[model samples]
Target: MLLQHAGIRPHPDYRRLMRALRLHAASPRGELAPEVYPADVANFFRRRRIPVAIVREGNTNALRKILAQVRRAPVMALVRGPEWGNEDHWIVLIGEERGMLVYLDPWYRPTQRYRRRMTNPVFALRWRGSAFSLSRGQAQSVRRA
Candidate 1:
């Protein structure tokens, strides 16, 4: 909920998950930034001894694996937003509710969701203990979190 970094949009789901992981963003001067880079996210998990896996676009096999993980715990995802359909956005997937993939999207009101079939997720971030092992393909990349 805090936009402490310049040139970054507020992403509620990202913030929520980061807080859940007990990680905080800090600026070069040790001030709160409330913004993080992709590398920073990876580093946080690494320091916490969590495992991370990355799935690229159109990887249905990996997508299926992530979906299974979501049944047990929250997962972070990057997808193309509906607005203008050009921007890639981040959201937290908090598992299924009544057959819908519940979204903690910052751009929408609370409790907003989409049908699982409607989403075209490009990337996924899953942590260990809550997720199964990622099946890495030539298109999939794995990061030790």
Candidate 2:
């Protein structure tokens, strides 16, 4: 979705990406916990020549500015809720309304999601702390394939 938003008509194969990154290794108990975290995503983007900027609570003002520029920035936020059962989930930040953040949940479980908007307190309630915005990769160094 972020790739499409950034004008990559055919998004990269996510399955292949996971395999390349060696993600989702199962434990001896046969528990598969797929971990495609914020840092991993950032590295992927950088590897694929897609520029992205990470923001966190440490830089609240800058992050807030990025959040406000939804369409222009194309942001994805990492959040955790009771619905995820101690796991983190990533959602697209669409817009801001009435001082609340409007997000789109891409979680597999539909029943877990309730509404789409959240204020600062509400965001805190969900343990959302990090976000990244897609931008110009042209300025960054390109890797030789």
Candidate 3:
């Protein structure tokens, strides 16, 4: 959805934000070049006058920080894995009230499908106090961008 908002099409081969960031292809200890990924994403949003903060860290702490930042402005997280061969990820937090949308890219097909398929499930308890939702159409819309 954030990509839809940004008017950027999702790449078919690299369907997830992290895959598109080229995070999976790096060596085990490889580090993402600071200027390339986050800077580019920041600039894209900046052109649209949307505030973007790219946080690079472990999931729990980084997510905490992102939630905090979302209180002040829209946030798009560009998360990298601690080591190479680990998948990187991106999650976009838009609007206040704790609503969010995540874009996860797994290196393997099973993991990818699992994350994408489990957006909302029956018998699953929905998260309360502001919900995070993903629209299936948004992924296709990203391709149209």
Candidate 2 structure quality by residue, lDDT tens digits, 22-53: 47567567877566666777776677666667
Give the clashing pairs for model 3.
10-142, 28-84
Model 2 vs truth, CA RMSD? 4.1
Poorly placed runs, candidate 3 (over 4 Å): 5-36, 53-63, 68-75, 82-103, 106-145
- lDDT-sorted candidate list, best first: 2, 1, 3
Give the lowest summed-lDDT range of ten residues in model 3: 122-131
Question: Which window of 10 residues has the lowest lDDT sum in candidate 1?
Answer: 1-10
The model with the greatest lDDT is 2
> Local distance difference test, per candidate?
0.46, 0.65, 0.39
Q: How far is 80's C-alpha from truth in model 2 (Å)?
A: 1.6
User: Could you give candidate 3's per-residue lDDT for residues 48-117 as a string of tens digits?
Assistant: 3443345554445544554565454444444434321333444344544223343333333554542221
29: Cα error in model 2, Å: 6.6
Report the C-alpha displacement of residue 119, candidate 3, in angstroms.
17
For candidate 2, report its TM-score: 0.72
Distance (Å) between predicted and true CA of 71, model 2?
5.3
Residue 66 in candidate 3, Cα distance off native in Å = 1.7
Write model 1 residue lDDT over 1-145, tens digit each, in one string.
Answer: 1111111222236556566444565667888754434455555445543445654445567677667766655556655535415554556665666555664666665555332323323233321212222222212222223
lDDT of 2 at 86: 63
* Alpha-carbon shift of residue 35 in model 1 (angstroms): 7.7
